[model samples]
Target chain A: MKILLYIILVTILLATSSARYGVVAQQSKVREYRIANEHRILEEFVTLLSIPNVASDHVNIRRNAALIIEMMRRRGLEPRLLEAGNSVPPAIYGEWKVPGATRTIILYAHYDGQPTDPKQWAGTMPWQPTLRSAALEAGGTILSMPKPGEKIDPEWRLYARSASDDKAGVMAILTAVDALKAQGIAPTSNVKFFFEGEEEAGSSHLGDIIRDQKLLEADAWLICDGPVHQSGLKQVVFGVRGDTNVDLTVYGAKRPLHSGHYGNWSPNPGLILAKLLSSMKDEAGRVTIAGWYDDVAPLGETERRAIEEAPHYDNELKTQLGLARTENAGKSLLELINEPSLNINGMSSGDVGALARNVIPTTASAVLDLRLVKGT
Target chain B: MKILLYIILVTILLATSSARYGVVAQQSKVREYRIANEHRILEEFVTLLSIPNVASDHVNIRRNAALIIEMMRRRGLEPRLLEAGNSVPPAIYGEWKVPGATRTIILYAHYDGQPTDPKQWAGTMPWQPTLRSAALEAGGTILSMPKPGEKIDPEWRLYARSASDDKAGVMAILTAVDALKAQGIAPTSNVKFFFEGEEEAGSSHLGDIIRDQKLLEADAWLICDGPVHQSGLKQVVFGVRGDTNVDLTVYGAKRPLHSGHYGNWSPNPGLILAKLLSSMKDEAGRVTIAGWYDDVAPLGETERRAIEEAPHYDNELKTQLGLARTENAGKSLLELINEPSLNINGMSSGDVGALARNVIPTTASAVLDLRLVKGT
Candidate 1:
């Protein structure tokens, strides 16, 4: 009993000491980071945004690659241009080594944006940055609209093609490193940057480039390619679900048949495909595949604990998503992202628009994405 | 023990007698169906084929409806047209009472063909019917192709919008009744023909018509729709899965943003929608919806036994369908078809074809069909 009382006393003392240390650290937090060179980072971002780096547009892509190389060299980093034959645009690689750092981090960001249809955009062109009031969770910073007359405030975030997806991520990383440099606090670890022009095109030749480049090696890979949490809190993703694209085609008759004339007699590929898809999972969302669950890796205790610990709003989410009720396994957001998944990305065949055509489509195809976790 | 033995013997004897009867019935199956007048049937089918009843074209739809009414009148059957105001073409109801019939059977079919994109059909006109040789399960059958003057034949079936669909089914039903008249063999059951016009439009107003019409009343409804089995065997369908269409839309921003710039920070509605869809199903094809199966009815013992008794070629079917394995229940076809289903019919938001787009889709939508069984 005396030993137990003494241990409790020590625990309380340690807890008090820890709390005090945390308070001191919070009080010493820096208010401003590199004010003298703040405009320079913004200038570099605008410069990168100025170039049109739409996917498969080789000329602009090459120009952007050169510009990125120049930016890296200006920061005293060794940057190189790597090519992957003719089909894919070239990639840019840069490395900054800390004198005594053993660990290295690789930052990946794509520079290209989807080709824009001017009519679909709200402004004159997609290449120009537009700014507007966006939700805090969606990047937080306010920005200007891309219209010709729209003026941008220095404090405002820029909105443009290739602006947020990856380019913004690229700029943020660069700025973070630059801020550290201004404080005379060099990176605590070796850092590498890989900017690719073909990520939008499924990163067609990225694996090849990664395989060939010795300098691109890293202890950790940080993919700047997804959204921040909906709560506006930044998260460190330990891993991501790898994806493979599946194009499924169901062939019916050689031509589109009238659903009316063939309603009961001719094959309806749409209905057949639907049945086939539904068969995979029961109404309860349980997969009915033979031996499908056998190979799946069970959730780890850590992941389970995280899921239980996380704040959840399943009921609210269901209402917001216009769902009558939350889906199975949707009780936790972590489970929704961590689990293996199959999605019917797109489905097409026959007439399914304004004017309904009673067509038994000859061929029905569904574009699907299967997200596989590390285990299965 | 003696009584048990006697019961077993009696059961064996009864089973043997029933088996013998089944074999005899199978061996001496009905070989032919006679039409009242083959020439008239063919001529009418040909005339109906010539009328271009393209969907959404009201003038053509009305013309076809008139022809159907005229045919019923010529056959000495009293027919009435029920038009759903502000809706598509009207439904045609024909009734004939066979003297001394104890039961009633309703024949349901639609009269509509898919609209033709002239560019799709080469050297063939949508309205013209041409004689062609099509290999049949019973051998080769000379049938009519969509366009006139084409002599080429395809194996296993003729290719026309309405050939094997309801139009042909309608012809089959009409020919059967006509045969009864010619042979002086009155139908054992009262005949009610409900030929619908808007069946091609999801038979949208048929429910209202069924509720409103007294003349169209019947003990049982025989939907002469869809197709015969792939094996070309006659099938009696007692049930069909009912469907509900749901359209989903997800909004990320007021406008599409460049994926490169906002890829990781701003919400990509396309990606969000894709992730949501993916979450609904897993790699083995399971829906992940929470209450998706709340009202699902389980298969009964009799249904399970029927499934076991049903003939199936799972391996052959998998190979023929180019599937590694069956998706749905992964059970027998009978078992699989006995359940409800959810299918992604169409999904669209951004550019879907040709090359991949890297922009964060501002909005995305998917059309889904949820199929329900009898109880659900």
Candidate 2:
């Protein structure tokens, strides 16, 4: 029985790798067109990035939607805004029908960017797209925008708020369409472009807009968001870990109290919160709460074999991240991501450094992000 | 043996209580004079508080010292500014000789206040002394300053940055001297006044000033700073807990990474810090570090008796603070304070609430305060 299972796992892994090779071949053609039009593509992307696209900024968000519509029109894809009502930012919709296509795939991306404090950005402003010689961490210096026909390094990073977030998704998907059209290469499937304007705002009105627009039917959705693999290798993730956010606030005294006077007696909210959060995870960084792993579905033989076949680059990643160890002692990164994970997006209590005062704060708050894999 | 120890403890408790009663009787005359000149006393205090006293503010800090010197001279005590050189803020010194006194006592307080952000002050400005019917937490409304010969409520709170800190100490000490002179009641000891102008700046030049001034010798030094008892009962404390502060910073990636893309895979500094901190304490909130409690000294017989005799108000305090439990389970607050403690003064990573972004922060930092008991 074990030998038969092993054979089946190897067969599945081989099939998956062959399919991935075909996608890579297609991507190379896409890459060629992108390289030829790097200047034009970057200029258009920079122009789109210039507008502030915070979801709450209604006027600016509409400006982003309008600009996206124009880009789609220039590509001869008739784009229209789909909105549940006037109060919400509309989703930009466009389509290209491949004759004799067997299926339709909706390319998903969002134009809206996360709210950012411009002061937190170093040297460059969030809305002004500036090119850096390399990643900022690599001591990258600011580079002037490339002149027309000037060579652009693919490794040169663009510094902007939504430079690699959802806005990058929209740019990449639309640019792929432009590349395909320019190369006279017709896709084997019908492609529908759906650019959302409020993904960063939690997509609260997404269901409403989707329901109101009856023509959004498609066989599958290709979400053009998130980052490439940390190794800079292209990857096709079949399913993303579902996510939910929880805001936790623990209370201490009703008002701030002098720490010197009531240090031991008064319960400090920061310490209390630390203890509470600590209780959720153990020394190996596994969630300790009851039923945390109880509902997790076991991986199939094929999935296990695929994970085993994946490249082992934890050492390289650890060195790049300046970490000597990982959360789980012996488990690989792929194995860990396949399970549910809890991460603290942010945590704060009182102030730190020069602004810190000797006071027991009234409250401590933390925002936790829980990521769930399939079946869990 | 237990019965004999208990009897001895009772005797020491009685002796301490009797001594406390005698001091309360002596304070009656001081309280009487304070009540009679309430308006005048408040007016002078408010005038002193109106000046910005941050130690870095050279001109204003000197103004505070000069005002204190003037106040001392008005009471027939010759005063002078004591300094190491021209660089640091000066310390105001004054001496009052009581004829035939057996001992001299030096009263210490600081005129300079901590650096404050005016924006943090609600309704009132930091340097502007504002009178309120009660504490701002109690929804107190602003009130006009009392006119000459007008009645002033003792319960009325004065709102300013340094109102209750060392400035309150300065005011109370000076008023006690005035009360003794007005009533023609001489204190048991000759009093020396030393008001520091840079205590908030960590008293770097204090030893220099003391070394240069040979007349600082006194039988006892009474420090008048910090807050009153939380229970509203007047009590005296001896041998303050020594404090040492350490700043801890944990690193994640060199740059912020999107939580969805890199979370679980990339080490989160905030989570890493939380795990590190949690390892230092246990479920009962006792420090679990290898030698955290090893250096703590056992209390003497008298100290143990005093702690036993002290009121058991933990239940009342717990109710007031909205705490269902406290550290160390059965141990009283007094017992806990007599032992060394570790507290997180402030902690921060990324941001919380509306400003919270789904990004793994590059670093997390915490200011830890180590409180050492005597002989630790």
Q: Which candidate is the best by DockQ?
A: 2
Candidate of highest lDDT = 2
Off by over 4 Å in 2: A1-36, A85-87, A183-186, A305-309, B1-32, B52-63, B73-76, B84-89, B114-122, B147-150, B181-188, B197-205, B308-312
Please give the RMSD of candidate 2 to the true structure. 7.5
B235: Cα error in model 1, Å: 27
lDDT for position A349 in model 1? 51
lDDT of 2 by residue, A118-143 (tens): 88889999999998998788988999
The RMSD of every model to the true structure, in order and in angstroms, is: 14.2, 7.5
For model 1, the local distance difference test gives: 0.57
Off by over 4 Å in 1: A1-60, A113-128, A135-159, A313-320, B1-376
Deviation of model 2 at A296, angstroms? 2.5
Writing each residue's lDDT as its tens digit, candidate 1 over A1-376 gives: 1111122222222222447675354223321442344445556777888888766787888888888888878777688888877657788888878888888887777787656566765433567765445533355453433344343333444556667666776666566556456656565668788888877666779888878878877787777666554343334456766666666677765554433223333344554555555555544344466765566677789878877776564545444434443234333546655655554444545533443353445665555555566677
Could you tell me which residue pairs clash in candidate 2? none
Chain B TM-score of predicted candidate 2 relative to the true chain B: 0.87
Candidate 1 true-interface contact recovery: 0.05
Q: Return the interface RMSD of the candidates, in order shown, one decimal each.
A: 8.1, 2.0
Per-candidate TM-score, chain A: 0.77, 0.90
